[model samples]
Target: MPRAWWRQLLSRFDPTPIPDPLWRRALVSCPLARRLDDERQHALRGLSAAFLARKRFHPLAGAVLDERIRLLIAMQACLPALEQGVRCLRGWRELLVYPGEFKVRRSHHDEHSGVVSEAEDVLIGEAWERGPLILSLADVQLDLEQPWDGYNVVVHEMAHKFDMLDGPPDGVPPLPDGINRRDWIVAFQRAYDHLSNDVARGRETLIDPYAAESADEFFAVVSEMHWSQPGLMQRAEPSVAALLTAYYGPSPAPT
Candidate 1:
């Protein structure tokens, strides 16, 4: 059998249940999860449990991770997967957590000149195509404390994971049966171009300026807005907001 099939089989057999007390504690820490309706809350609980079962968590840089912290992380991580179902989380199984912001050295080769340049970037969160999801534990805690501030490290990284599901991060994930793929591409492209142009001209933009970096970043940034500040997202880009609502179900954040 294929590796994915094997993993699915293992997941089916090992259904680790998140205890009631633990679940309640996690909900207290996670406003977004707490706001979910009874039905969605139940779904989130199951997804969180599955996430704990299938993924490995590593605490680095003196980060202290307890069971409750892990559960809290799982709860937030599973939120994006709620609408897409657990299958959207396929192809990855590790989460690396640092105590705070971390620096990563990256080398980029210029295609034109064939010269390689190396740089170190400080990041709160990052998701690789087929590698671990990395995060700063401090940022994660801050998001839990302030859930409506238009920033969520977990959700932003999760969006990239979903974007990479169909291949590379191209601002689009695998669509369901009824969602029009061409329409998604067109709407997102127009929105991305508009943001890019605004940023190029140094004009004020409602969406994050970082989103103007690329199409994939635009998708991830908008996704953060959808979950953390739905009202702002809708006001800034109603079309993109509507598409995200359709893709990820209704936002659990307060209006």
Candidate 2:
């Protein structure tokens, strides 16, 4: 049988459905998931079930992991993939949760000098290309408590996953039918440059200055706004906002 068929057959035996009580509890805690329309909410439920079925979750550093918490995480993680379908979640299998912030060491190689410099960076969440999705459980809970704060660790990392689906993240994910690749590149490029300029001038910006770091970060940061503070995104970068709206479907976030 084909790979797709084999996966489908396996899914038939995966016991991943969230019970009604657990689902209701999770929805009550997650404003973003609660705000989704009925149609999309239904899709999210199925996609989340699939996520739980396919991915392995490991709680580290004595982080408390429970069914409710897992369901909550799955719900938010699947939001970005709602329109794209569960297939968008392909190419990853592990979800690592830490109690709080984690530190990761990085080695930067200077291309001209060929000097390797090392540094440690703290992260709330991280998504690796074709690897595990790492997150801080505390940060995930914080996002639930402050859903409209214009930041969402799960969404941000999931955006990176989407961006990396085709290759290394360059701010562009695989476009769906009816979305012009050239148009996406032009609009994203202009928006990214504008934000980069503002950050360089030390001006406060509506979109996160972190987004100005690179095209991929820009896409991921704007994606958080697309779901959390879409009005701000629209005002900051109408073209990019429109593109995100088209790609992610209408914002369930309240204006």
Candidate 3:
């Protein structure tokens, strides 16, 4: 009889299948989804429908969002959750979309100097713990246009969301049983250290240097590569790539 009980009961049921025309149209626009084998593609469609049913979307700063674009966003946002399942999508309920890059003001505190500074950041996508998922519509479309470019704003931000599930983003999400947590930590730490060293020395590296920003960002960045350019990721860091494949299942990126 309680709201929580009702919500739990409702979560057990799958949302209605996405309308045929909309699903086909969105699928045509997104090569990553198009490339998925039939079975997984079937799962993705239902998961995406669940996403559209559960999450609320808000268009801000002159951004335009129709049902078609919303379905497109939902499809990509739910891609990372296919292996993880629909439960992982539960914590967040709102999505804020911007026309392009949106700016957020931040305050940085110096650890030893006791000084605080304020700055602004231009971001294309971001995810918050138990909060809203934000994105730039233009960049989302760009990712659809350039599917194999090793970057996917939706996947990158969704990775952050998954990482935040257990706690703050730590480059590690809660693993299902039988997957050794220690192995994940060791493999990711070694790869993160190597990338950080390369970045510090100003060496060009295969994995994005932006990953060196932090372990959590490393996970998110590699997640983007996992979905968009797993081949390149395998070439750059085979161990990490193997772990990712094991965790996220095989990449659907084009050969």
Candidate 4:
């Protein structure tokens, strides 16, 4: 290859590395990521750097997004991509942060009734297909302090992003080579049905009842459990838990 070709390739692919101090500080703040083994942690640093380079951050509503906090968010966002590698982070380019909960005005249409209703939804995090990743700064900080709480706004929204990769969020993201798509769909559908039944009967449940909302929401909620409380998920749905572990790699949550 010509020397000019090498420079262009480098500019396109090689992102600026995170400085050692920034990496250490960000890692220290993110307990979920701090639990990764040294090799994976190093890999995460590179991924985080790439994420920061490729994604634009829009801090709105007085969201205090400093360099350290930005780096912290990048590290957590990239944690789920460690095993999948950087390819999984493609097709998106924005991260929007709010100081706290944000409200979105949404329109809902009923197919059978031909009725449309508009409502405002208060959200901590949300992801749209081929759009920006939105998050709550307060929730992100809370997850950092209570790392094992089985709730992470960033991870939950990121799961939706992953699910939307191949197409719409149908609870199944693009699978890796070893993971069978049929098996994944079967396991997740079974678990979603079980949870839906329990919620319908008004029974106590292990996984969040919000997961019963839809297939994609179930996937996102379980993904939060996978990173923060895999044991809880294992107890609720063994097969789904197993598949999630296989897809995202082992949970860093304390055993």
Please report how far candidate 3 places residue 253 from its true position, in Å: 1.0
Using all chains and alpha carbons, the TM-scores for the candidates as numbered come to: 0.94, 0.94, 0.94, 0.94
| lDDT against true structure, model 2 | 0.90
Let me know the TM-score candidate 1 reaches against the reference structure: 0.94
Descending-lDDT candidate ranking: 1, 2, 4, 3
Question: What do the candidate models score in CA lDDT, each in turn?
Answer: 0.90, 0.90, 0.88, 0.89
* Candidate 4 Cα misplacement greater than 4 A, ranges: 1-12
Candidate 4 residue pairs in clash (backbone atoms < 3 Å)? none
lDDT of 1 at 152: 94
Candidate 4 overall lDDT versus native: 0.89
lDDT per residue (tens digit) for residues 14-46 in model 3 = 587788998999889988889888877877787
Could you tell which candidate, 1 or 3, scores higher by lDDT?
Answer: 1
lDDT of 2 by residue, 65-159 (tens): 99999988998898998767766889999999999999999999999999999999999999999999999999999999999989999999999
Q: Over the stretch 81-150, how does candidate 1's per-residue lDDT look in tens digits?
A: 7767888878999999999999999999999999999999999999999999999999999999999999
Clash pairs for candidate 1: none
